[model samples]
Target chain A: MGSSSAPWKQLLLSSIEANSHLKHHSYFQLATVSSNNRPSNRTVVFRGFQDDGDKILINTDTRTRKINDLKHCPFTEICWYFMESWEQFRISGVVDVIDGTTPDPLKLEQREKSWFASSLRSRVQYVGASPGLPAVASEQSSQSPSLDPSIGPVAAFCLLLFDPHQVDYLNLKSNERLVFTSIASDSGKKLWTSQKVNP
Target chain B: MGSSSAPWKQLLLSSIEANSHLKHHSYFQLATVSSNNRPSNRTVVFRGFQDDGDKILINTDTRTRKINDLKHCPFTEICWYFMESWEQFRISGVVDVIDGTTPDPLKLEQREKSWFASSLRSRVQYVGASPGLPAVASEQSSQSPSLDPSIGPVAAFCLLLFDPHQVDYLNLKSNERLVFTSIASDSGKKLWTSQKVNP
Candidate 1:
């Protein structure tokens, strides 16, 4: 029952603060379950996180394999590497999908804008009107909308919320590995003691 | 039948050149097979690559789970991500463990020095008297000549070499994903072109 004031807690906070660019780090290696329960991994960008550090948010297209996997199995592990320092942070947690119906409007707007900016609308059209859709080519050829259209109302996007249960922080400087397990109780949030593991 | 001058090849060459930091970017995600045949991935630093991009090398301790898995299944996939930009490269191929007995003295020296610097002799002493053996508390009190020495010599330091068979280059900016497969012949001395899958 150690408090969050432990050295490990400070280390985690300082690491993230010192490496502020990690927030905008383009890709994170995401591990998800496949149809047969096998694991598959891909890189995805980091969106942001909550102020309380209770949850982290990421954006992904609906067409991606990870989105489909998240629909089935919410358990996931995310690996983030800092290129400059050769430090790594591994987080294992449960993922929750947040859609337009989410309570917070600010969160919804941020998610929508990010998704829209990352969409492949122009490229999708260049590839010729969605491969499988039959009638779309004819309709598009008849009266095509401009290439750079406004974010349409029909566009659908979602935000993924990752609540970490365990975080393994490894610093290559001293080849040191530290594991921090986060537990939330009725009183408040508490981080257990850190264990030094073999690197 | 396309030549190396194809768009994908140019794209890859340009990406590698533009992102010069990538060559020095140490962290890479490595996927290895577990006992259950499932894939387990973790971060490892990139040591170097061959002149022709034929082989990629990584420094690993014999005690790591990845090295153990490689003993059982030599097939692995390495994912390299450049955080500053949305560029990622995936290399899947067979792994060859190169030991100190390797003919190339330069490679041997590089591997040994990497392991020595990474060992942090202080922590190695805490682990145990024998280099590879874990230090037992009772045996910890016993003094041995080996105890004063560095673990680099006795440790089974090996270089994990991955000869690329398939490569997937993804540039999120242009929404372009390029997949290239290579065919190796003559004991990996010569390579041939294979089909390029649509990305």
Candidate 2:
């Protein structure tokens, strides 16, 4: 929403660009608090940003347990490690779940866009049996579910917008750490501030 | 504590063995709830297991914020991803902090053992300025702190014993997932059970 890019966003974008060669660099760990207050962590793929803002985009299946976890507690943290650069970014944010059940039209359109953005192979998984269930004998084989990509997002396809308020960036190679925090401004917009700290 | 190794432990050991070539294979993300009930996560090195038990060992500096988070909420989750094997393990457990103030002699011995097990280079960081603090001009240089390894753990060194009660193992290549849970037995022992689930 600001004219200039946030300092943390610039650093994060540079880190991502530096490690673009590694295929697995797109994967990061997401931590969420369950209803019982227990923490749950899992690996999730980075889909990109939301509307050129600090909101991080992610795609998930509606049937996954993390979806329920988000419902109970929207606060989450993303721990992304760039092996090549030896850097780690721990982004803490609130997740806005944009699923088929969402009431907002713009959010639903974003969900549809994200659904089509995914590769066909990745999209087919949403149509299969729900995650964490006992594998059905017939669906055990390497079979792809027939689906028309033009039909837009299926019911199970979901999108997550992680609106980050704090980012803890640590570069192991340089032994430097910086924390970026977003503060609500007078105009209802967020302002970012960064401080250098010992790693 | 049992005659046979737990199923999840065996699977995790196999994954570690398979990815031993990767230098970062020992690194994993630890997520803990802060005092404010927000989730915070960061990467930590996996020291080893505790005395052939399921308790995972990790060393950290007491000056780090994670130490305070663990104090507020002992429950944490360890998310480990083996890139080569494309396997992920999510371990949820309660952390038992073995710091300098702990009273038990056996736990203090374990903490001391963990201290000696860490490399000299790793141990020196604890003796320096606290993490996430403004870097002092004097300590900003490449000077190494002088310390005798024989002296054992410093006051800043802390040991965390993650006693996992549940593990979620996912193999991307095989499209399979398994949930391992530990239940308390009649004799005050823990028994593990594994169930196959969809990825």
Best by DockQ: 2
- Highest lDDT: give the candidate number: 2
Residue lDDT tens for model 1, B1-199: 4343323445545555676755345567876655555445678766656544557777665566666778777877677776556677776678887666678877677566655655454335334433223335565346532443454544556677776667777666654455666654567443444332223
Clashing pairs in 2: none
Could you give candidate 1's per-residue lDDT for residues A95-192 as a string of tens digits?
87766666887767756565555555532433233221223335534654444445432333556888777777787776567777766668876556
The candidates score, on chain A by TM-score, as follows 0.67, 0.96
Per-residue C-alpha lDDT of model 2 across residues B27-126, encoded as one tens digit per residue: 9999999889888999999998999888999999888888889989999999999988999999998999889999999999999999888888898898
Candidates in order, TM-scores: namely 0.63, 0.96
Off by over 4 Å in 2: A1-3, A141-143, B1-3
Candidate 1: where is the Cα deviation over 4 Å? A1-13, A21-26, A33-40, A50-53, A68-75, A84-86, A97-156, A182-191, B2-16, B21-26, B33-40, B50-53, B69-75, B83-86, B94-155, B182-199
